[model samples]
Target chain A: MNRYSLNQATTKYWPLEDVVAASAKAELDWIGLWREPVQEYGVERAAKLVADAGLRVSSLCRGGFFTATDDAERRAKIEDNRRAIDEAATLGTDVLVLVSGGLPAGSRDVDGARAMVTDGLAELAPYAGERGVRLAVEPLHPMFCSDRCVVSSLGGALDLAEQFPADQVGVIVDAYHLWWDADVYRQIARAGDRICSYQVSDWIVPLPADNLLGRGMMGDGAIELRRLREACDAAGYDGPVEVEIFNQQLWDAPGQEVFDLAYQRYTEHVA
Target chain B: MNRYSLNQATTKYWPLEDVVAASAKAELDWIGLWREPVQEYGVERAAKLVADAGLRVSSLCRGGFFTATDDAERRAKIEDNRRAIDEAATLGTDVLVLVSGGLPAGSRDVDGARAMVTDGLAELAPYAGERGVRLAVEPLHPMFCSDRCVVSSLGGALDLAEQFPADQVGVIVDAYHLWWDADVYRQIARAGDRICSYQVSDWIVPLPADNLLGRGMMGDGAIELRRLREACDAAGYDGPVEVEIFNQQLWDAPGQEVFDLAYQRYTEHVA
Candidate 1:
């Protein structure tokens, strides 16, 4: 329970105020946030709201999508990422998760798209570093490689992150996205201090119509949540274990109920 | 076109007779057969049908699902695999593709399941070799790791295959599955003569309800099909490049129409 953090996405429909209050009420030490809701609630207000409730912001949801075919679109994506970095800084979170965008539309050049991600990170890492924000490169499940993130493995993320300082760029080890790899344990160990965030979610089968929302709650699917968490801990990631499920059923549940269940599962399956 | 082979699964609903006749009419040199249809039509008859049509069986569709919780069930799966080897032998194809089963139900031990795959291969490899069949271990896309296959990357498959004689065991380099990995090209190079089959299928986004049927025609999705085929060739694999798509739309189309479109796409994207 001491290391448990309820990522806002677990209860996506829950208001910022309600989530902050619930985290504090639940006596949690940290709360992970998303950029959209924090901006909507006013970054300063959201920051103060969590600070007032004595909950530290664990991380800001995202800041990448660098793959684009044209220069104009690529520049625009970089600009959007700069704003996300600023938002992460303002929210008082050191970590800003980046879901590196997929290949550009109508493009079969995966190498070119990955190169774009490398360029995006090179452009943003220094800017993020100055603001005390670590850009966490999240390797989404390979299923999302075509339309979501091009970084599809922790090793791939580390390859990109190795180019930058550990404090400026790191990797997010999300159980649901990585549990399938036979090399995961080895990669997790290699992650070491570059592990900026350790997120726990189970891999449920028969992924729903919207595969993005197919993440199951911890202990609900095939992932070895505790084993992964222990691997992170052994790798020296003494940080918040964020429960960040994106299932529609979880979203429809009462905010407090979802939060409670997440905390319970974290204790049982991840702690 | 000389290297092109159309796997029967691409037109799953098409009768075997029509498929064989269509392949012969298309002037294709090779065809890949699935176990179920070949068994349904009687293995000897299907073998004769293709042989008489001047077409060769490039490979057999499958012979795995080795992970099972119970000892009795495990033995049954091994027996089934032996029968699959015999079927492949009868069909005059050296390669028998294997989709290693996922974690057993009520199990979180992925490592244990992978071990089961290794054990299954060790037991069957000698038997397969005696019958002139090379067990081609296919590392399915990681999305299917929990349900369809635990061997989720080319490197993982290579690790399993390297344990046995190259003549007895090999790996399947399916572009649709291995295309997303950054380490894929290096792994392909490492495969060398252990490459048994090179399969091509485009990976489309917004995967359908049945994720298994989400594979797209070659030119319709993001995979760098030509690059992957070239990689296989560079790795000393002068084998047939099988177009194995599992899409609902392809299955619903007229068999010849689908075959024509696949040949055209394979010419443009994979050849």
Candidate 2:
């Protein structure tokens, strides 16, 4: 109970104020925040709201799409990432999740795209470290490799993160994105202190038309949720266990109902 | 091209006889065969039809689904695989591509499922070797790891293959599946003589309703087709470069049109 943090995206339509009020009512110690909504409600206000409600931000949703075709575009993306770092700092969260951009449009140069991700991290790690914000690289499922993130496996994410100091650049372990990997357990173990966040969501098949919203609730799909959570625990990750699902069905449901349901499922399937 | 092989699945709607006749007319030395269609056409007759057309069978479509919950079910799948190996022997092809089955219906034990695959391979390897057929383990994309094949990377497939004699068990390097893997080239190089087949198909985004048919034609997606082919060559794999695409658009197109288009793209993007 002490470690549970409901990522705002899990109940996307839930208003920021209502979510904060609900988390406080439910006596939650932490809540995950997204950049857009936090900014929309005013970052300072949102920060104050959470702090006033006796809640802390577990993590900021994301900021990394560094794969661009030219120097100017790449530099601009890096600059945007720096602002994201500032946002994380303002929110008082040490972690900012990153979904590394996919291949540059019309390019089959995957290696080149990966190099851009490495360079982006190198450029941002020091800045992030100074701000006490860890850029947590989240490896998306391989299905999203061509269009969402070139870093498609935990090992691949670690490969990029290892080039930097652990406190500065770490990785996120999202079960929805990594449950199918055979090497995932070993990678999670290898992640050790570098694992900045642990997220949980099950994977259901016959993915929806929009694959981005295909995640299932914790107990409803085939993932060994508790097993993965335990693996993260064994690897020395004692941070908030965030529930970050992106499903149309879940989003369409009533916010409080979904939040309560997710909490129950987390206890039954992941905690 | 001496190394070209037109996998029948690429032009799936074409009658097997016509695919054979067209390959003969095109002066191709090799043609890939699928199990159900060949079985429907009478295995002996199909074999004679192919041999009579002066075409050698490059490889048989599949022969694995070894993951099952009960002992009886597991044994039945193994028995079916025996029949498939016999069919491959009758067709005079030495390669029997295996798409290892996914998890048991409601099970989340991925490691247990993988162990079943390894045990299944151990049981079939000697029998397959005796029939002069090499069991070629095909690692599907991680997207298919849940409902289709659990083996999801060249390195993972090789991990299973290395447990047996190379002549008895090998791996398939399909560009559609392995192209996104960061360690793909290294795994291909490690494969060495354990490489039994190399299949090609491009990967396109916004996967269709049925992801099994999401494969794109070469040059239509972001895969580095020629680069992968060159890597296989560098790894000492001189076997047939089988063109295998499974797109609804390609299936609906005229057979000869798709066939000709595939050949052109194979030359432009893969050869």
Candidate 3:
């Protein structure tokens, strides 16, 4: 149906209610939201607002940041993920996004961290599965390989997924991250039905300073979106294509203006 | 013995003969050379000069840009690799560095290109193995992901290595491309004596416009060199810690001055 979901981090400077209101006005059927906004206006209040607006929660923005030098921090992250899963379940969202954490502090050991992630995921898998929410490991761009997700490829994510039960693990292929990967096509095919969600954004060359929020909107960058969507279709994916940008500039604009521009761009490019 | 090899491309602007003389005068036991010098001076002449100077060739600079749309073009690359192996044999180099090609013309499919690389490598392995030369896949920076090697992570390179015979496949883990990776230690361990070569360079933050050549000389950038070297040590890697700087400013300096500064920096920080 070419359904669209706006990930609120795209314009996170705006309040959750404002974003929800904008989505409802735009007639977007779904939304991918961050924990920060959900917390700001209590989750209870956020829930009521979503229901009031008649928007489906596509997936939670994220949960996993599992890498840690010590056991205590890792445990804390696991507990946080448990809370995130509960939130997703409460929201009736089918998926909880997981960003595999980057390297631990003062430690150059990545495999150990990856092992730690696998252990953490395996421990958390049962709880997520029991709640009917799958863990969607989102492979971040390789530029973030050290400080962000260690699982930087769809193939790497799928390889990790293979270690657990199919019902328990899947992946979120963020276009901003996956677009630059030369192996995206075959990996997406290999991901096949395990793809829990698909996202849309652009890989802005000469990435803006303050990179965490510098993501460009779809069609503003060089991503081959239709081809990616086609790959998703070729591999039996029929989920909502979410517009999840993290642009500071967009957040400064009026919500109505941002959504209209995003919707138009999504239709022309990503949809 | 803690020996060093000057990769000629580190001072790429210099003439082949001059670069060779500089390496020899610097008292470096070995040198990693490129194809251009050989092409300019003829392989026999270049080989004789390095031999007369009593310097060993640690490895040849490169062999593959195998990714391409045309079938015959791919075949020609394979044939070129064979010639590179022959050149390696004549120059007494033990390895040939291979940069995985970028996206083929008008193509955004990375997996297909990777498959082409894997197939091409499988074909090239036997020829290289027969000549006592090994193919060392050097994963470039993530910026080159769309246009360079599909194997971005050390683990990705390791996975590729697993496909071929023990002596035939290995990787070159450069500090510049991999310093940010959390999995560096574990991947090096898994690389397990499969690490045929190690290249050293530093990453400059606020990347320059000509990112390709604007590398930071060691001690000028953010990498924790000793720890990474320690990981390489723990992984049973006894290969030469080759310095392969690609900085435009450094390139402009006289060859001897660059080598003197490089050795001092390596000893102080990386050794």
Candidate 4:
């Protein structure tokens, strides 16, 4: 209960103020936020609202999508990441999650796209570090490797993160994205101090047509959530366990109900 | 053209005899077989049909689904694999590709399920070797990791394969499954002599509702098909380059049309 955080995305329709009020009423110590809603509500005001409610922002939703064919587009994405870093600092959170962009349109050069991620990170890591923000590379599930995040494994994320100082760049271990890997436990051990955030969700089957909404609630699917959480704990990641599910059903439900259900599942399956 | 093999799954509705006759007409040296269709047509007759058409069976579609909660069910699956080995031998193909079953029903113990795969392989490898059939572990994409194949990466498949005699058990290098892996090239190099069959299919975005049929044809998606084929060749595999795509569109098309298009794409994008 002390370490539980309800990521705002789980209840997608929940207003920023409503989520903050709910978290405060629930006596939750942390809440995870997304950039759009934070910016819409005003970053400083959102930060003050959470602080006034005695809650901290676990992380800012995202900051990377650096893969681009055009030089201007690539530069703009990096610049956007710079702004994202500033937003994370403004919101009083140290971690900014990154979903490295997929291959450029009509491109088959995965290695080239990955190289662009490296270049983007190289340019942003120092800037992020200076502002007390850690860029957390969130390796999406390999299914999303083609259209969403090119970083599809924790090992791959660590490969990118290892190029920079641990404080500047780290990896996010989301159970939904990584529970499939046989090497996960070993990689979690390897992650050690580079683990910036630990997210919990289950791997449900027969993914939605739009598979981006395919994540299941913590206790309803196949992931060993508590085991992964314990592994992160053993690896020295003593941080908030954010409940970050992207399911359409949860989004359509009442926000308070979804938040309560997520917290309950977090206790049963993740804590 | 000298190395191309049409996996029967690519032409799902084509009768076994028609596929063999078509391969013969196409001057193809190889054709991959699926067990159910061969069994339906009678294995010996299908074998003779393929041999009569002068098309050697490059590999068998599958021979694994070993995860089972019940001990008796597990034993039956192992026995079924033995029959599959004999079937592969009768078809005169040494490679028997295996899609290790997903986690058992209502089970979250992935490691436990994986142990079942390891144990299943151990029991069947010797039997397969005796029949001159090398069990080829095909690592399905990570999306299939939950409900299709618990062995989700070439590295993970190789981990299981390395525990057995290389002649008895090897890994399949399927481009669609391994393409998204950042460490895939390194893993392919490590596969060396353990490589059994090389399969090609493209990774397309907006995966269909049934992602099992989400594979796109060569030159139609994001995979670097020729590069992967070359990697297999560099790893000392001089076997048939099998085009194994499972797509609803291809299945609905005329068999001859699909076959010819596949060959054209093979020459342009894979060969």
Candidate 5:
């Protein structure tokens, strides 16, 4: 059965191991793991915990951030993504999410930044393909247009994914970021089976204080989740809806409380 | 020739007619008047005042909040637009700025809302066309997707223009709203001669307290103004560079000061 996967970032106040244990405690079917936590607890421990907790590793949190000042640093990011692909494979995660990094520092060339992403993805794709892991390029909000993901539209992601004909290249469409796009449904239809994951959240505040981070939880914001789901469904998209909120206040909440909130809101806001 | 056209909402504190006088005092070449102000002054008085002040109406503030719950109110808005068209004609302003309203109240049907806009545009285009008034559909920021403009991309605007091909159909590629689009340049190029006016302002914050209001003056935000001009130039778009900033703080200052600040920022930022 396709089940709810809480991107542990919702309960990021807790340590990675604890969050995994708590997701297990909450009986969540799957968990989306973040990088820092995996690195802190070590990949072996994270993998062991996922096995013990009976949680499917839905996706390894992130891999890309290819934009950089120099070629060597850019190459280093590619190497890191290769490692991330391996890590996702070890964790039995089918998708390795790629966050195409924002503009290289002091550079206003978005086209150049995108070129770097495509080139980096070219390097990471073969490795990820060999490891049996899908690469899901996530399109963030244009508010992150400067320092975060350069992939701001689903069309841009689709353009990038077109470079790879196989299923290894996919997109992670989040409601929080893409709920406003005029062509989101068309893009989702374009994505089809390549939509590795469907992320849900609401747009609570009109203005986000922190551009890259401040995401609202379900029901608390303006996005009508069921409508978005209807759009995805209308587009013939069937994939796991990952609850990925980056609310600072939600992160500070107790782990169980966060899980309870996510669950409660899931039914009220997301369904 | 470059002309300074003060979009009135940037200084909401001034009443309709007073803004007209102040605009003339500032030696601005043009003024973009909103509907409320004209209604407040009455169409005859509003028309006479601009004529008396020797001011040019660059564009009428707008028409088309087409997404409505009932047909009666929607028809009423169209009726109101007709009056605005008459007023624009009376004031010798041929540019009728049309912002396709946001998703209807208590609705998440963006596509339905957009269809309503295209229909509205189709209905109004012939009338405005006969009157020699070109309706410039302004594609607002993605943030306005909920309660403001549904047309969030330049491509979306171009598509509308294509759908209703007329000398009357054009676009207002406001930099603050469109600076972040991945295909902004391409879409602008596509707009070509259909590009009626180019507006400039900076996005000071991602989401201000008043999302509809609170625009940053050019140079205050991250957008590279010169680069935008270069892109527009490359696309063969040579039209009036309308300085349209909706900053509450700037509006609060004296009217002449507002123009002074706008002019100063334009020269400094666009330099």
Candidate 6:
């Protein structure tokens, strides 16, 4: 319970105020946030709201989609990431998760897209480091490789992150995305202090109509959540264990109920 | 088109007789068969039908699912695999593709399930070799790791296959499954002569309700089909390149129409 944090995505429809209040009421030490809701609630107000409740911001949801074919589009993405870094800084969170965008439209050049991600990170790492924000490269499940994130493995993410200082760039080890890898334990050990965030979500089968919302709550599917959390701890990641699920059924539930269940599952399956 | 083969799964709804006639009429070098249809059409009759038409059976669709918890269930799966090997032998196809089953019911021990796969292969490889069948372990896309196959990468599959003689065991380089892997090129190079079957299919986004049927025709999605085929060729595989797509839209189309479109796409994107 000391390390448990409820990522806002677990209760996506929950209002920012309600989530912050609920986390504090539940006596949680932290809450992970997304960029959109914080901006909507006013970044300063959201920051003060959490600060007033004595809850630290564990991480900011995202700040990358840098793959683009044209120069202007690429520059625009870099600018957007810059704003994301600023938002993370303002929110007082050191971790800004990055889901590097997939291949450009009508393009089969995966190598070219990967290069763009490396370039995006090389440009943004210094800016993020200056603001005390660590850009956490999240390797999405390979299922999302074409349209969501080109970085599809922790090893691949580390390959990109090792190019920069560990404080400037790190990797997010989300169970849902990486539990299927045979080399996951080895990579997790290799990650050591490079693991910026450790997120837990079970891998459920018969992924819904839209696969993006297919993540199951911890202990609800086929992931070894405790094992992975232990692996992170073994690798020296003494950080918040964020429960981040994106299931439609969980979203349809009451926000408080979802939060309570997430906390409970984190206790039993992750923490 | 000398090396082109139309896998029957691309037009699953087509009758076996029609598919055989169409492949012969299209002047294709070979036809890939599924176990169920070949069994239903009578293996001997189907074998004679293809042989009489001057076409060869490039490979058998499948022969694995060995991750059962109960001893009886495990034995049943091994028996089924034995039958599948016999079917492949009768069909005159040297390659028998194996999709290792996922985690056992209510189990999260992926490592344990993988061991079951290795055990299954070790037990069956000699039997398959005696029947002149090479057990080709296919590493399905990781999305299917929890349900359809536990072997989720060429490297993982190789880790299992390398324990057996190259003549008894090999790997399938399916473009749709292995394209997203960052280490795929290196794995393909390591596969070298261990490559038994080369499969091609494009990976389209917004996967359908049943994600299993979401594979698109070659030119309709994100896979670099030509590059993968070249990789297989460079690995010393000059065998038939099978176009194996599992799409609902393509299945609903006329068999000959789907076949013609697949041939064109394979010519432009894979061959």
Q: What is the lDDT of residue B28 in candidate 6?
A: 78
Give me the displacement of residue B254 in model 4, in angstroms.
Answer: 0.4
Give a tens-digit lDDT track for model 3, residues B51-78. Answer: 9997888889898888988889988888
lDDT (10s digit) by residue, model 1, range A64-148: 9999989999999999999999988988899999999998988878889999999999999999999999999999999999899
Docking class of 2: high
Q: Per-residue lDDT for B129-236 in model 2, tens only?
A: 999999999999988888888999998999999999999999999999998889899999999999988899898988998989999998999999899889999999
Stretches off by above 4 angstroms in model 6 are none
Model 1 C-alpha RMSD to native: 1.0
Instruction: Give the Å shift of residue B235 in candidate 5.
Output: 5.4
Q: List the residue pairs that clash in candidate 6.
A: none
lDDT per residue, candidate 1, B1-271, as tens digits?
4888999999999999998999898888999999999999999999999999999999998989999999999999999999999999999999999999999998999999999999999999999999999999999999999898999999999999999999999999999899999999999999999999899888987899999999998888998888888989999999899989999888999989999999998888888
Docking class of 4: high
Q: Residue-wise lDDT of candidate 3 within A1-271, one digit each (tens)? A: 4468888877767788888988888777887788877977777778778988998888887899999888899899999999999988877788888999887865545667678879988999999999999999888876666667677778778878888887788888788787765467888999888888889887665555655665787776657887898898788888888888877788888877887888899888877
For every candidate, what is the interface RMSD in angstroms? 0.6, 0.8, 4.2, 0.7, 2.6, 0.5
How far is each candidate from the true structure, as Cα RMSD in Å?
Answer: 1.0, 0.9, 5.3, 0.9, 3.3, 1.1
Pairs clashing within candidate 3: A10-A245, A110-B182, A110-B183, A182-B110, A183-B111, B102-B147
**Model 3 regions more than 4 Å off:** A122-132, A159-169, A179-194, A208-224, A230-237, A247-258, A268-270, B1-3, B11-22, B35-49, B60-100, B104-138, B148-198, B201-241, B247-271
Candidate 3 vs 5: which has more lDDT: 3
Chain B superposition TM-score per model? 0.99, 0.99, 0.96, 0.99, 0.91, 0.99
Clash number by candidate, in order: 0, 0, 6, 0, 3, 0
Task: Please give, for residues A1-271, the per-residue lDDT of candidate 5 as tens digits.
Answer: 4467888777877877777777787777788888778877889888988888988888888989989999899878988888898899889888988899887766667888889988987877887888899999999877677668878899889899889955678888889888888777788888777778888877764555564455777876657677777667666666567898887778777888888888888878766
Model 5, stretches more than 4 Å misplaced?
Answer: A15-18, A25-27, A71-76, A165-168, A211-214, A219-239, A264-271, B11-28, B37-55, B205-207, B230-237, B253-258, B264-271
Could you tell me which residue pairs clash in candidate 1?
Answer: none
Reference-based lDDT, residue A229, model 4: 89
Q: What is the C-alpha lDDT profile of model 4 across B98-152, one tens digit per residue?
A: 9999999999998998899999999999999999999999999988887989999
lDDT on C-alpha atoms for all candidate structures: 0.93, 0.93, 0.81, 0.93, 0.79, 0.93
Kept native contacts, fraction for each prediction: 0.88, 0.71, 0.14, 0.86, 0.36, 0.78
Error of 2 at A175 (Å): 0.6
